[model samples]
Target: MTQDYGFALARERGIALGPIGHRIVEENELTRVWEVRLAPGEELGFHIHYHPYYVVSLGGGDNEIETIFGKTIATQEPLGHTVYIDEKRAIHKLTNRSDQTYLSRLIEFKAVRWTYDDDPAQARPEAGEQTPEGYAAAFREILEHTADLPWEPKSLKGLYQKMLWRDEETGASIALIKFDKGVGIPNAHAHASNQFMYCLSGKYRYIPTGTTLVAGSFYCNPVGSVHGPTIADEATIFLEIYDGPHYPVQPPWYTDPKDAT
Candidate 1:
């Protein structure tokens, strides 16, 4: 049996489709990771994007994106560039037009499947992880370059962050955080929703649980599960994501209201 992927309207509109990406490297309950690479003049045939997703550029190059509906775009992708797309278009394709190969890792949110419909409730926050809102009156498409974005200081000393994307209503967000060596969270804490992190570099440790994160480490902390009093053994950088609101109440570690998000 095949998944409906709920493309009734897309089919009715005569859109064609293909696989989501070039190659699947990993998949779990929450996400599917894809490695996308295209040599010069290579094209990815029409494909569907049925879930909310983001792309992390490993290497930058000129590329063109064409929708079956006929609109086309040509853009310069930058190294370390990131973008989040919430639109669930059923027909589109990309072609590498630069001299060098274009490489990226595209991650799709599988926990939430978005199908265009009129639903006001999706714009509202829920108790757990949320699905992408295809029906959102204004779903955002955020683009950022790690090298170009300035890191905002957190209230705590030696802590900083580059906010990539966020939901003002739900407090859900994705960010790149930095912790200087020896800097630490002074107390145990939990979050309002599941927290996910991928270490980009250096080492960080949870004192209470003795759990540690090193380069390439992946971590997940469940909602309301107490754990922390963490320290950076070395200067560290990590990508953090929250499935829903961040905290039941602002933790004392942060004095800046903006840091709470």
Candidate 2:
């Protein structure tokens, strides 16, 4: 004989279990990334999310999500997909309903300031247009199938990105970047914002850290931190969340061979 976990019981007792099946891959002033895996019939026990966050699905599968209000939503998440949830204090539980295991990367944003601005390059929805119903209504704000988003090429060759979410006021943005195999930029560059990178697939070497990062590895470079000249050993896909806009300053090593005056 076993006790059944029911919705009423969970709400009444406050769902004692908290974030099961999640491993902290990395953390910094700006973000915390968790690598999560749940086998069939496993659940990441009820937990509260106090900050804005995003989830990148590494393995697609069926799942059931129960909100603190006792509402349940079933979804079929796709691999490589990403979703963003606005900051709200909310509790929820997730259960893997598929026969296979479910894998995902959860990135939580901390210390974010939501200052609304009207920058043409920042294409996020207007604050007024966002849900006014609070955290309970934020369930509808989740974006799915992020891999289907269009890729925008940066100034760097052989590198492309898909901007997922951006906040003009805070200058925070989330993006998925792809690097072709053997793509190496010979520059020790730095950015104005803090950046956190999580390797979703493939392998690459971060020259500054002298570390070879593979799938599930993470790296953090704070504001004004100088690093890079990344070399990809294989086609690599990684998730990057930064505090401000990306403007990589060219280093002396990046000088053009044609301008050798």
Candidate with top TM-score is: 1
Stretches of candidate 2 exceeding 4 Å from the true structure? 1-140, 248-261
Clashing pairs in 2: none
lDDT on C-alpha atoms for all candidate structures = 0.76, 0.67
**Per-residue lDDT of candidate 2, residues 43-137 (tens digit):** 88776664577787767589999876678999886565567888543357898999988887787766552321221222345677763334333
What's the lDDT for candidate 1?
Answer: 0.76
Question: How many clashes in each candidate?
Answer: 0, 0
For model 2, state the Cα shift of residue 192 in Å: 1.1
TM-score of each: 0.52, 0.46
- Stretches of model 1 off by over 4 angstroms after superposition: 1-49, 52-140
What are the per-residue Cα lDDT tens digits for candidate 1 across 81-181? 66789865535689989988888778887756664342232234555756455334234344677899998889999999998877665566789999999
Error of 1 at 49 (Å): 6.9
